[model samples]
Target: MVESESTTKVNVLMVGTGEYTTGYVGGGAADSDKGAGVVALTMFDLRRRNKVSRVGMCGVNGKKFAGIRSHMQKNIGDVYNDMDLTCETFPEDTVVDPLAYEVAAKAFYPGDVAIIFTPDDTHFAIAMNCIQRGMHVMVTKPIVQTLADHQKLAALAHENNVLVGVEVHKRLDPFYADARDRARSNLGDFQYMYAYMSQPKHQLETFKAWAGKSSDISYYLNSHHVDWSEWTLAGMARPVRVTATGSSGVAQSRSMNTEDSITLTVQWENLNDQKTLGCAVYTSSWAAPKSDVHSQQRFFYMGSSGEINVDQAHRGCTVATDAAGFASVNPLFMKYTPTNGMFSGQGSYGVRSFENFIDACCAVNAGTAQPRDFDDGSLATVHTTMQGTAILEAGRMSLDMDGRPMDIQYDGNDHEPIAIVPHVFTG
Candidate 1:
C-alpha cells in the first residue's frame, strides 16, 4: 500500500510463455505459439501511450525465447532502467529461468496485478498462483474447458478477492458498446438476435492445435457466435433446445478432423414458459474468397421500430427501414486496415485485451479498478461449450455429447426458412 503524493502505480506479472504445442489434428503438428503478439504490442503501446510504467513478464524459457529475447528484453520497458512507461527499450521481457511462474507470484506486490497470456488448459493453475499471491489476473478467453473447471475458477477468483476477467474484445470495443447502448434505446423492444462468423481455414488448424483431436470445429468457431448472441439477446434465452446441421465436406476435404460448415438452430423460451423468436446462426470456414474473409464480424437485431446491423467486418454499418431505405448513419469503423493498424498496432486483439485487464487490475490494486470478473467469463464459456457441442452433434447426427443428449433449444420457426437439417439444409 505504498502511495505517493502525485500518483499510485500497480505492477503486472504474466505467466505461461513456454513455447507450447496445441495438440493439433492429424497427428498433432506444431504451429506458432500465441501471446507474444500481445506482449510486443503492449510494449509498443506503453512506449507510445505513456500511461503505465513497467511490466514484469514471467514464464519465458531459455530455449524458445532464445531467438527473439535479445531484441525484446532491450525494448519492452522493464524496471532495470529508470525507463518509466513512456521510454522504450529493446529485447522483450521473457522472464525466463527455471520456475518462472512461482518466481513471478512471489515478486508481485499488493498494488500489482498479473496477466496470463497462455492457453485455456493452463488457466486454473497459473490463475491459482496469481490469486493466492495477492495479485489480480486478466486471462484470455475460454479459461476453462468444462463446466466443472468453470465452477472451480469462479470460486477461486472470489475467495481470493482478486479480480479476474476473460478477454472478450467485443465487450470492451466501443464499436460493440455503442451498439449495445442503442439496442437498449429507441431500437424498440429487443426481440431476438443473430451473430455470424466467417474465418479462414487456418483458424481450424489453429483450433485443432489448441483444442486437440477431441475438440470439434463447432466448439471453437460457433462458440463465439453463440456467446455473443446470449450477451446481446438479453441473457441467452436459457436455450430450451438447440439443433444444428454441419458439414465436414470442407474439413474432410482438407483432411481435418472437424466440420467446416455449421448452421445453429437455437430455441429459446421467453418468460411464462413460451418460446419466442428463434435465433439461428450459420458459421462457415468455407466462405467465398478466403483472401477477403475474416476482415470483420457482423450482427443484426430485430426490434419493433427498426433493425440494426453492426457490420463489423467492413468497420461499421448502416441501419435501414424494411422498405430498403437508409434510416440513419453511425460511422464507427477502424481507420486502420487489419493487415497493419488494428491487428498490428492500434487494435490488436492480444494487446487491447491485455491492456484492458491490466488497467482493471491496476485499478483494484490501487482501490479503483473493475475487472469484468470470472462469473461473466464462466457464463459465456459454458454457453459456448453447450451450443458448440450441440452443433457438433447435429453434424454427426448424434444427440449425445459425452454420453448425453446435450441439452439445448431447437424449434421449427423461420420467417425466411432456416435449415434445421443439414441434409435438407445444404441442398
Candidate 2:
C-alpha cells in the first residue's frame, strides 16, 4: 500500500444509514439531529474556513431507503449525483449492503480514510481492509465487542502506524472540554466520574436476542460510560478488575444470553486524591428513582473546586460550583434552529454529526489534525466490558424482579467477565 495525501479536498463515505434516518425528523427534532446536523455544519465550515470541496455519499447505487444517501443527494446539492461509492444497486435501501465495502476500497485512493459508521461487528473487516490497503480509518464509538478483537486491531495499527478513531463525538463537544479544563487547571485531578444510559429490558427483546444481542448493547451504552470516565479524568487507566450481576430477562423473554441491567465497581490504580465517576443504566424493569429525573443519558464529574453535568435528551452541559452558584450555567451544545445548518439551501446534507468525520478526515489528510489512536479505543472498549458486567449484576437484585427493595452489593470482581465497539482511535 502506498501513502496517500489530500489533493485539494478529502472524500468521505458513510457506511451506515441509521444516522441519516435520525436526521430526517421534521421540526425542532431535526434541529437536534446532531449526527446529520454537525456533519452539515462542518460542510459549511469547510467552505467558509478552508475553501475545500465536499466528497459525495458512499453506498451501492440501487439501495433506496438510506436517508444519509438521500440527504447527501439532496444536501451536497450540485455534486450529489456524482458521489456514489458502489457500481451496483444496493440489496435494499433500508438494509446494509455488505458488498459496498469492496467497492469503497476500490473507490477511494490508498491514502483516503474511510470512517466506519455501521455496527461494531462490520468495523473489524473494513478497518483491517483499510489498513491492509494503506488507507486511514475512523469509526463510531466502541470499535468491537471483544478484547481479542481489540488486540488484533492494536497489532495492525502499530504495525502500520495508521491513525484510527472512534466516533466519540462528546470529546469534541465544548461541554466535555470544560471538564478537561477543570482537571488540567489545578481545579482538581480525576477523583470520580459517573455515566448512565439505562433503558427498559423489554426494549431489548428480539427473537435471537438470547445469544449475542446484548453483545452490542454491552459495548454500545458502556462505550459512552467508559469514554466519559477517561475523557473527564484525562487519565486512561484500564479497569484492574470487575464483576457484574443482572438478570437474563431480555434473554429469558427472547432466548438471549445478555443481561438487561447491571452495576459495576471499576478499579483504576491511578485514582488517588481525585474522585471517580459512577456508571448507571436503565433496564425495562427499572423504576424511576424517588426523584423526578426521568431520562436516559447522564454523566457527572466532581472536582474539588466545581462540578459538571452532561445530559442527553436536553443536549446540554452545565458547570457549577457551590462557591459561586448554579445560575451562572453555560450552554455547551449547539442548537438546531431553522436558521441553523443549511436547511434553507437547496440540498439535503443539511448538517449532521457524520460531517465531523469528514472534517477530521480532511484535516488528517492535510496534516492539520491527527485522528485518535487504537490505545484510546482499547481503553474505553475494555472498561465498558467491565461495566456491563456490573450492570448485569445490578439486575441480579431482588428489586429487579418487580422493582422491589433489595440489597445491592459492591463486589470488586463481580462484573469482571469479558470485553465488548466502533471506536478505535485515529492518531
Candidate 3:
C-alpha cells in the first residue's frame, strides 16, 4: 500500500448507467439478481473497503439518473449497512447529451480508472479518449467490433503506458480455470472442441439498439467461449480458418434485423506439428426459451489422448419460488445476498474480476507492477484477447457472404503479435 494518503485510493468514473451497471433495464429495476447492477454495486463495495476514491457515473439520458439512483438506493444501498449510493453524475442530471461520457471522463487523471459498461460500438471512441488522457480502462466483452480497432486500442494503451483490460469474467470460474490447466497439461495435442452459450430471448430487448445494427449474437455471446478457447490453448495452437453459418427468420420476424443464432467452425493449426490440426465449433444465441437457468453454457473438448466435458449451466442447485417460479442459481458469479447487512461478495467471480483490476491499478500506481505483468494468461488483457476479436469478426464476414470460409491471418507470432485483416471471404 502507498504510504502517502493522497495517492491511496484510485478514482473511478463509471461510463454507463444501463442494465449491467444500474440493473434499471427497460425503465425499471430488473427482477433478476442484478437489480442494482454489477459494476456499480461492486465499486460501491470497493470504496467501502478503501480501495477506490471518488466514484462518478455518466449516461446519455440525464433524466434517468433519478430513477437509477432511486432503484439503487432501494435495491442496494438500503439493503446494505452504511452503503452510500452517492456519486457524481455527468451532464448535471438536467441535460440529455449523448456525449456526456466525454465530460465525466475528464475528472480522472493518469493512473486513475474508468470502468466502461456501455454498448459495444461506442467502446472504441470512449476508450480511445480515456487512454489518450492517460486513464486506465476496463471495458465490457467483445472489446471492439473490428480487429483494427482492437489493435489500435492496444497500441494506444501501450503508448500511454496504461492498463486496459477486457472484463471476461468466465476465467474466474474455478471449473473453467481447472479445465484450462488440465487441457494444457494432460489433454494432449488439441484435436476438437465444441462450445455453446445462450441466453433467454428477452435479452433482445435489453440489447435492442445494437442487436443487429452495431453487432450480432456471435460478438455478443460467442465471445465468451472463443476467448476461453484461446486462453486455454494459447501456446498450443493457433486459429487459421473459420466458416460461419446462422439461422435467421426468428429475430427478423421480431423486426430486429439480426440473426437468431450463429455457429462458427474454426480451424486450428497445432503449434508443435505443422501438419496436425484441430477444429472447434462455437455456437451462440439470444433467442432460446426460458429454461430453469437464465443462461445455458457448456463445452466439450477432445485431444489426442484425453477429452473433457463441462456443463456450466446445470450446477446441481435448483430453487423454486411462488413468484419467480423454478430456477437454477449460480452464486459463484455474484452472491447478491448481503451478510451482516453489508456487501459481502468478495468470493464471487463477478466481483473478484473488478477487485482484481482495482488491485492491479493500485499496484501499478505504487510502482510495483507493470502492464505486462498481467499478460501472463491470467486477466483478459487487451493483447491477449485480440485473436478472439479476429475470430468473431471473421464470423461476421462469413455470415455476410453466405457461410463462406474466412481466414484469420496474423502478422507476427506470440512476440508482439499483430492481427491482419480478417473476413477474407471469397466463395
Candidate 4:
C-alpha cells in the first residue's frame, strides 16, 4: 500500500465508544478522574492537526450513539471552541450487535488504521479483523488476556504487513523515560524492581460488569507496571519465571469475584548470561480509598550500581478548594487546559503515544519506514511487547493454579525472542 501523496491522511475507525471514547459511562460522565475520556479526544485533536482523515466510532449498542455524540459535543467540542467531533457509527439505531466492529472495519482500506479500546477479552478479535482487512491496529494494554492470542495477532500482522501496537502510554512519561535510560546506562544490570499502581474503589463500579466475570484487576491495572518493567529491561534481562498472589475481600464484598489487589513476582534471566538472574515484584489494586489523586502509582527500581524511585502520584503539584477538597493533578497524561482558545494536549505523553502510532502508520504508508523499524522500540508493537504479554499471561495462570509459579520459556529458535507459556490454563 503506497500513499499517493506525502500529506495523505489515514482514515481511523474507533472500535469502542464507552468511557475512553465518549466518557458516557453509567449514563453520565465518568465519576472518577477522566471526565471526557482520552481516545476520542486525542483522535479529534489529531484530526485538527491534519494527521488523520475521517473518523468512525463503533459500539455494540447503537442506542447509546446519540448520548455519546451529545456528551462529546458538550464536553469535548464545546470545551475546545466547537471543534468538529463528527464521526460515523455502526450497527445503526435500535440494533444491538456485538459483531458491529466487523461492519465498521469494511470502511477502511489497507493503509488506514483502527484503534481498539474495548474490553481486554475483545481486543484480539477486533484487532485480528482489522489486521485481516489490511488496516493498522492499536489495542489498549494488557493487549489481550492470552499469550496465544498475542502470538497469533503478531504473526497475522506480520503476514499482512500491518502495524499492531499496544497502547502502553506509560513509556512516554518523561520521568519513566529517564528511569529507563538510567537503568540501561548508569544503573547497571537489573537487580530488583517493585511497582505499585492502584485506582479508587469507585472504578470497580464503573467496570463492575466485567471486573471478575471477564477480567481481573491484575489485567486492568497491573498491566501498566508489567509493560513498564518489560520496556525498562528490554535488552538487559527477560522474565523467565512468574508467581502470582492476590488479596481479596474488598471487591468480593461488593459482589465482585475479582482480587482486591494482585502481585506478581517474576524472575528475570540476564540477557547477556542466562546463568545470572534478577527479580521483579509488581503489584496493582483497584481497592484504594479516595485519595488526593485518582490513581496511586509509584515504583522502585534497583540495579547493580544504583537505584531509582518514582512517585508518579505526587508530581509536586497539588490544589485545595472548599468544594473539591485537596487533590493532586497530572497534566502529563491529558492537559485539559486550553491555549489560545484551542485544545493543546500535544505535549502530553498520553496524546503523544497515539500520535506516535499514527505518525508511524503514515511513514509506513509513504514507504519511508518499514513495519520492523517500529520493533526497534519507537512504540510498543506486538513484536516488541511479547515479553510483557508472556509475563502477564503467566501471572494470571499462576493465580489460577493456587499461586503455583510458572516459567516463561523464550524460544530463541525464531528470528527474534518469542515467549512461550508451557501450558497456560486461564481461569
Q: List model 1 lDDT by residue over 290-346, tens digit each.
A: 443233367777655677777656543445566535422222322112332223344
Local distance difference test, each candidate: 0.48, 0.46, 0.85, 0.86
TM-score of each: 0.64, 0.61, 0.95, 0.95
Cα error of candidate 2 at position 380, Å: 10
lDDT of 4 by residue, 271-368 (tens): 76545788999999999998899999999999989999999888988888998899998998888878877898889987899999999999888778
Candidate 2, residue 162: CA error in Å? 3.0
Candidate 4, run of 10 with poorest lDDT: 413-422
Q: What are the clashing pairs of model 3?
A: none
- Candidate 2, 218: how far from true, in Å? 3.1
Off by over 4 Å in 2: 1-5, 20-62, 65-97, 187-190, 199-214, 235-238, 247-258, 271-295, 303-309, 315-334, 340-427
lDDT-wise, the better of 1 and 4 is 4
Between 2 and 3, whose lDDT is larger? 3
Query: Residue 25 of candidate 4: its Cα lDDT?
Result: 94
Off by over 4 Å in 1: 1-7, 16-36, 47-51, 58-62, 70-103, 188-191, 204-208, 214-216, 235-238, 253-255, 271-277, 282-289, 293-296, 316-353, 369-405, 408-427
Q: What tens-digit string does per-residue lDDT give for candidate 2 at 73-181?
A: 4544333222222222234445566576776667666556665655556777777887676665666666754455655765676566555555565555555555666
Which segments of candidate 3 are over 4 A away from where they belong? 1-6, 31-33, 415-427
